[model samples]
Target: MGCMQKCEMSLGFESGSVTSDQISCSNQEQYTGWYSSWMPTKARLNNQGFGCAWLSKFNDQYQWIQIDLREVGVVSGILTQGRCDADEWITKYSVQYRTMETLNWIYYKDQTGNNRVFYGNSDRSSTVQNLLRPPIVARYIRLLPLGWHTRIAMRMDLLMCMNKCT
Candidate 1:
């Protein structure tokens, strides 16, 4: 994630190019905001919405926030941060992706073939970055929290691959 930061292009989250409609989460639309007002759209990096970040009711591994790139493309890295107004944040997570809605999701595995557990932020404001070696070419991406501080809360940014034109 060190050098990957300088090379990858942000995939439009911070700039609003990735519209709110393109973002969704598990257990969404299944209920109303009577439990929480934390929308998936508030997960953008540096978001200052009323919620300030995505606050999940279920902290289990089953919960996730997803992004639809709208088409297949290279995803190089991810940037994560905790909730703006609380001490909640993800401490560890894994990634899953696919090129189409009907396709099966695949975990971004480590060199050893195990699902890669990317370390995330420890505090509420600092950003933690994780690079996908051999980056993924997919239209949809999901970040699943394996462990977190207090509970599962996150604000994030996705980095697009910067390939040299040949």
Candidate 2:
């Protein structure tokens, strides 16, 4: 299939809504139905994997789980968020895209490190943002987890895969 010319795709989980039933991993049932029940000690989807698990000190603080969609075509924008907890940890975030298919991930824009990002430690709430850079033909994307005032881990709200519009 040909890539879409102008498309916006988003891929992510639904905050605290992600239960063991939603995640199809071997250890998925360990957490059951509670969002704060388990921390992602190790997670991998598609062909990417996150090696570290989430850790927090306070149950009141918030955290984030994000992905970088290496330009698949033309991305109009992207967004991410957490659920159950309060929106305090995440302040801002940025999406770094590239056209390379290798594992090496280059910065496609300025590092959006905790500035204008939102951290909602909830179970279903989500946040969306527009990509500053135009979409390019890419094959590698990276998800950077940022923000955390406590020791508790953060969950994903949604992961949108914005492909070119057909």
User: lDDT: which candidate is best?
Assistant: 1
Candidate 2 has an lDDT of 0.37
Query: Top model by TM-score, which number?
Result: 1
CA deviation > 4 Å runs, candidate 1? 1-7, 34-36, 162-166
Query: How many pairs of residues collide in each model?
Result: 0, 41
Model 1 lDDT per residue over 23-129, tens place: 89888775365535687888989887578898887889899999999989889899999999989999999999999999999999999999999999999999888
Worst 10 residues of 1 by lDDT: 1-10
Model 1 scores a TM of: 0.90
Candidate 1 all-Cα RMSD: 4.1
